[model samples]
Target: MSGAAPMRVLANATELIELLAGEGALPLVDVATRIGVPRPSIYRLCEGLAAVGMVELLPDSRVRLSTRWLALADAARAGMLEWRGAPEVLAHLVERTGQTAYLSVPYGSSALCVDWCQGRAIDVLAYRPGSMMPLHVGAAGRTFAAYGVPLPEGDRRRRTEKTIIDYDELAADRERIRRDGYALSEEDVTIGIGAVGVPILAPDGTLRGALSLGGLVEDIRKHCDEFVAELRAGVERLSGV
Candidate 1:
């Protein structure tokens, strides 16, 4: 019958979970500010969530929704009768471009390739699903990193003669990617492969992953403008879906 009891009832674990999940990744201060709760209370709630594997604390102390959510997503994808259409999207892109197309999601300090479609043209370098790329390298990794994901410390130490390794330089590149809506890497990872990458964002604006195209630098150079246009168009179509 008391208002105090009603207030307590409104602040259940479910409410906390819903808040964190809806907000995607958030710092303690931002979460506290958004939820109108004190930092200590938010930290305690995050600790509880982290204990249960629903949330994870990043190295920088930011709290993020965990991979456990992917289980439910995978389950849903398994049940959907029309879900078989997913591969065709990547297939269509590869078919059109005649280059390796890849979809990757950020995992820990790397980007994990979750899906790929290889072109008919043979290439010395090929990537398969589950292959991991360092977050500081390649177009897919750079796309994810550009959207505020932390790059691994060790990766920063290994500087490609042509690549940006300094934090400030990397930060500037990230800002450029954010503004340009795609990432371009020429021999940043492999000597012969050039990559073009676009970030895939969720409806709520959180970074879901990145879609990338990899091909020989000479081939890509011949169609550089067209390749970027097609890559951006493909990502736009996927984002709508």
Candidate 2:
């Protein structure tokens, strides 16, 4: 007799998170369409995310991810690694390549360096803990941007003459990065400093973060294949594969 009085469960927040992540910033309509949920339900989920610092509601009625996710990810990294991120893995890369290695995650519309291990031969430190880089500036940042993270205007503005400030060029680079599963920033942030970056994705295919190794341009280029292999191994380990 009560079969007609069936209860309904609400959509999980993770669904909303994964949608926003795959499509980048989007208006409620896009999310609703993608998830086959009503616009109002999507709006409600977005509102909840905005309240929790997981997302930001734009004046243009779009929703974007907030930087707070980075902090949460760092917290989760605890006990997994001695600190936050694949420190032991990064150390291995440093040992193999003799370059500074780092783990970066989306910081609002930018990229934040969560953890790093410096190589023995390095003299300059490009990104240390708490150091933020514009999403269009470096390998790590570009990795996030290419994988659906929004790039801020500051990243669009050139830092040095070598930086890729042109939107068209950046778009082209994004395409390449998407296809390759990795990227190289050739002095795009700082002269004489270059990096190779790979995206770290959650099992759900959401972009959780990125990993990068920075050093001289030629050095990274010389060991590009090796670095990518090591980086992939590190990612597999970090992911508990």
Candidate 3:
């Protein structure tokens, strides 16, 4: 019973970290309410996390993740040996396309953004490092699915009216991506935003990851072919790594 109790606390701590990562700083009470845990338990968890440098308690009674997590995230990114050259590739893509570039890998039924380079244009708040997008929702996720990663089963959330939530439509979309050798998402994840992505595949055709570019809907639509060219070139550079 003693051992089990500590494990439960650890699990709760993980949930707390995830919540902080997604929602940013929040008061202890709000955290408890959102996490469905008691106030006393959450307070203890925050203190324990703070002691370990995983999170910090603000002067205003809000709790936020510590900067130490940045180093840990960097270390995790470095550990993916296959993506060693991803940063440079993303940078090059951003330079050529003038759109935000991202490197993502399949995480279960989601595409996890591990690295990104912001472009000179508008900022895309839909995804960032350490964020995950469902395989049916975004260009990167769709690229993963078209290239062999399994699409998640069950009802998919519709982020916008353009999001393909129907199974048949999603299946057809995947087919189009496969046939075209790239995935294109127009206002699917975020309204007024668009993205194009291609799979980073191993020599035997196994998916290694996804390379994508995103920007305003108009810019993405007008320059899609050019963006796809640059993205494909970047993926080629990554393939050599």
lDDT of each: 0.74, 0.78, 0.89
lDDT, model 3: 0.89
Q: Model 2 over residues 1-241: C-alpha lDDT tens digits?
A: 3644222213446656655554468887777786777788778778877887889999999887788866775676674453344777788888878888898888777787778888776667567765677788888888988999876654266767888878888899899999999989888877887889898888899998888899888888888888888888778877773
lDDT of 1 by residue, 1-241 (tens): 9988557645745556555553467777887776677788778778887898988988887888788867865675456443244466678788789988887788766777776788766666535554566677788888889997888776353435656687888888899999998888777776777878888787788987887888887877787677778776777677656
Candidate 2 off by > 4 Å? 1-85, 153-155
Model 3 residue runs over 4 Å out of place are: 2-8, 25-43, 57-63
C-alpha displacement of 183 in model 1, angstroms?
0.6
- RMSD (CA, Å), candidate 3 to true, equals 2.9
lDDT of 3 by residue, 1-241 (tens): 6999989898899789877876689999999998889999999899988998999999999999999988999999989887889889988888888899999988877788999999889975588998888898889999998888888787487889999988999889989999999899999989999999988888888888889999998998999899888989998899987
TM-score of 2: 0.65
Index of the highest-TM-score prediction: 3
Instruction: Return the clash pairs for model 3, or none.
Output: none
Query: Each model's TM-score, in the order given?
Result: 0.62, 0.65, 0.83
Of the two candidates 2 and 3, the one with more favorable TM-score, higher being better, is 3
Clashes in each model (backbone N, CA, C under 3 Å)?
Answer: 0, 1, 0
